[model samples]
Target: MELTVSPAPHIHDNLTVSKCMYNVIIALLPAFAVSLYFFGIGALIVTLSSILSCVIVEYLIQKYLLKEKPSIGNGSAILTGLLLAFNLPSNLPIWIVVIGSIVAIGIAKMSFGGLGNNLFNPALAGRVFLLISFPTQMTQWPRPIVSRWNYTDTETGATLLSKLKEEGSQWIEQIDIANLWIGNQGGSLGEVGAIALLIGFAYLLYRKIISWHIPVSILLTVFLFSFVLACGQETGNMQNIPMWQYAFDFALIQLLSGGLLLGAIYMATDYVTSPMTSKGMIIYGIGIGILTVVIRQWGGYPEGVSFAILIMNAFTPLINNYIKPKRFGNHRS
Candidate 1:
């Protein structure tokens, strides 16, 4: 008797790369809506301009350089565009935003062997490049509710971090935390509103697009560190500065001020740029948190989430190598 065996069953999930990216875009919608509500037409204009530039650049690079049809339909390019725009100041020149898109799609994403192979987050890399190239323009955040289309003489609003940097604790007392939460304060377009970011984060959690490990770890680390530092300051050991009546001000400064929420939730969690293992994610989150606090507290730049995330992205390969997942039913060697 001859017996024939069939091929083993292969399990496949319905999830596609495009779907994952689209989910991220959907998660970002609440933040986008909030930003538009606060910043008006300028925010929308900047976001659309960045998206258009990114798509056009990706198409050109794929068609001419890679000799393939552009995969703009995959949704990664749009995500990158949205993120790049979010990181930028709303009043940034249109041409500069276009340049940033080119850097993100062409140089950072396409040049590194395209989507899955890039070592760094393309939008972040592009933002860093722009920050270095145009320090004044990049840091000159526009006042909320101002129109980008029509140049108007509005007050040059300082971000929370800048206020701290320029005037230290004296300035901190004057800032309204409610305004910070509502995006009435000055900062990057998408990072301005803490409530909006948390809303987006909730959607991502509900959709199961990302795990809680990285974001929670990062936020906790920042909070704990800031608390410890604030305690030291209260005791007159850290900075010899007078303690504020409210001790939790530093924590609020950390949470509601800059790009920490945005970076921790979205940028630091990039699948291709972050570590694969759970332990690796925790460690990565901790490192980013520490670096961010260090930079914000002592380094030259007031905001450090972008630089911190990029630095952590560089170490992801090393993290994955050492923190390999254990095999099922395998005994320890």
Candidate 2:
């Protein structure tokens, strides 16, 4: 009889690298369906192009550049591509989508030794690169429903966040919260679908793919911070609405609008870039929430989730160092 000894993780379940990645993909499907319904052909084109480009780029980089076996079968590249596409305007040109994919796989991912080692979320890195390189195209969000059949030629409109940033509280009453929740507005493919994103979040939780620490902490921080700000401001057009009501509505908008939900639930929860410990995750999420609000309120850009996640990603190592879980089998004196 032969006995084999392994390190910690001796008791294992059916989970694998591929399984986790695919689970995330499955979770993202509801959001993708909402995007297709709202953005139509443009969403499909952008998504396909991004996914194909990411897989191809990673395959080629591994096979030729790194002289290693391609790992696209693990589904990391596909997830990266899907997330990148989610961060982008659906009407963005295919060439630009390809460029972002290449950056995502070739630089942010492959250059960092391919998944599980990257410093930043590959999708956010690629999206930020594109946002800087092609600000005009990236910001021109196609209007939902009306742009169904259109691609790059779709009619464009400002997102709710952008409107709020530009016009302040005056335009608050005009926003149709119901329509926004159901994704009948202008924004990135994933950003508009609040309900779909929440559904996906629930699925991820049900599958135990992610813990509640990161997502819940982020939402709480953003809500409380935004609520404080909302209550302090004098909008002057309250129109008989109670101040608390205005504050609550504004906080709700912060939760539903732009990429807050998607980023909080998906991107900030990336295993490689996020802290390992639950306490560390909460700290990381809090940092992301604060930075997101700061950038949206004062920074040049209207959206801040991508930037917030990436910035927190850079600090994950530090958070892990300081906030580690107790070592297994170790007892107190």
Candidate 3:
């Protein structure tokens, strides 16, 4: 074979879109397994139905509607399906999962020109849509393990965020940190557990699938803000806590509980929806963290990670516009 000489150095990445998607799927498996172990058949049904519905919708839209090569085999739709299910209650009806799948893949994704061109994170958008449309069903959190086998009739209860918002620091006195960390509380299928989300986060970090900018900034900002609010007596966020230890404990609980871990680690770091540069990513992360705390503390909802991420997603374009990446071969200023 004759050699065709070009540049002095040659480097092969060998990483394709499919490879990246599969890596993300692997990272997400820990959370999926945790949900399955906690919710049993309900988790299985919701996940499978959502995945199938998303794949089917994407297939039909690409093959018949969009008249493009079917990209369902790339696993984006399946990932979206899994993520949307993760954000929802395990006891939700199958029809609702289907609707969420449609909204995620069809509206939030394809409507904005698919995959790399979408505006918001499709799964988060679908989740917010469901939460708004079906408030009661969306907030119905089934107690974990206790309702492992049960689906619709599972024993349901409120999340830590709800307790913190309504009953204040009383949630700390009632529920210990161990239960919250290990995810024994009631909430969405995947969002309930901190351990599982951490595992996935570690895997993603190991595989270089995601960077630490967005997640770390978001988590740190949340900690600092909550610490200030807890220690400060302006609006009395953490009342009845005289000691500093108790105040820090409440802030820790707020960090580990709810969808903060899930959204910060996975949803907010979405490749197409998030900012490009490191500075932009930090700004975006800070915005999400602040918005999340604001919504949880004073906004109408107790859990605000989804809404926070979506709102930040809308600002991504502006962030990119101002904080742009350095040019390849151009020197200016």
Candidate 4:
């Protein structure tokens, strides 16, 4: 009899990198459809441009610069591009979309040794880069449905967070929570569609593409923290509702508005950048949630999900070091 020696246990399932990437793409389709419904032709153009640019940039980098065979068929670049596009305004120029894709695929991903080795989420890195470099363009969110066909000339408006920041808590009363939930509000492609994002989240959970720890923890933290803040504030009950109900409504608004759902469900749960252990995932999620709220309430930026996720991504290595996972199998004491 011949004995073969190989690396430990060696149990493998059918799960592959491409399978996971494609699963995420499938999950994201609902949100993409919502964006198209709201943003129309602009959404289609930005999404396609971002995806093509990312794939082409990654392929060129791998083949020409890195002197390796391109692995563009694995769907990582496509996912990155789709995520980048989601983070962007629908009315953003094609040139900027191409540049953001370059930053996402070239600098954030390949420069850090490609997909699994990147410290930060590539899509977010690209988004932040564009936000900083093109502040006016990045902040110009087109009105939903009405501006769907206008592209660069779309009439723009402030996001709910921006309205809150500019007009104070009273403006909160005027906001239709139903509209926010149903993708009828003005914001980025991803920010407006809370229900769509939630649907995608459910699909991801159902397919076992991700565990519940990260998304749930982030959302719960945001809800609780925002509730506490709402309770502390002394705003008149403009709607004649009870203070407790008002606080609850405020917290719900925080949870459903802007990119909170998108970031919590999709971006913060990136396997490469988030912590490995379940406990560590919770810790990581809490950090993201806290930072996001702080930045929204106090920081200069109106939205903070991108910054929060990237900041926590930098801490993932430290979290893994401190919150070490238990070794598998039984051990004699």
**C-alpha TM-scores of all predictions:** 0.91, 0.97, 0.92, 0.96
Evaluate residue 207 in candidate 1 and report its C-alpha lDDT on the 0 to 100 scale.
80
Superposed Cα deviation of residue 181, candidate 4 (Å)? 1.3
Segments in model 4 whose C-alpha atoms lie over 4 Å from true places: 1-5, 237-239, 329-333
Order of quality (TM-score): 2, 4, 3, 1
Error of 4 at 76 (Å): 0.4
The count of backbone overlaps in candidate 1 is 0
Q: How many clashes does each candidate structure show, in the order listed?
A: 0, 0, 0, 0
Question: How displaced is residue 256 in candidate 2, in Å?
Answer: 0.2
Model 2 backbone overlap count? 0
| lDDT string, candidate 1, 26-60, tens digits | 98888898778766767887899999999999998
List clashing residue pairs in candidate 3: none
The Cα local distance difference test for each model comes to 0.85, 0.92, 0.88, 0.92
The window of 10 residues in a row where model 3 has the poorest summed lDDT is 232-241
Best by lDDT, which number? 2
Q: Any residue pairs clashing in model 4, and if so which?
A: none
Question: What is candidate 2's TM-score against the reference?
Answer: 0.97
Q: What is the lDDT, from 0 to 100, of the residue 233 in candidate 3?
A: 35
lDDT of 3 by residue, 155-231 (tens): 99888899889887655666678877777777887786788889889998998888999999999999889888877
State residue 74's C-alpha deviation in candidate 2, in Å. 0.9
* lDDT of candidate 1 at residue 3, scale 0 to 100: 86
Segments of candidate 3 deviating more than 4 angstroms: 1-12, 233-242, 328-333
lDDT, candidate 4, residue 163? 91
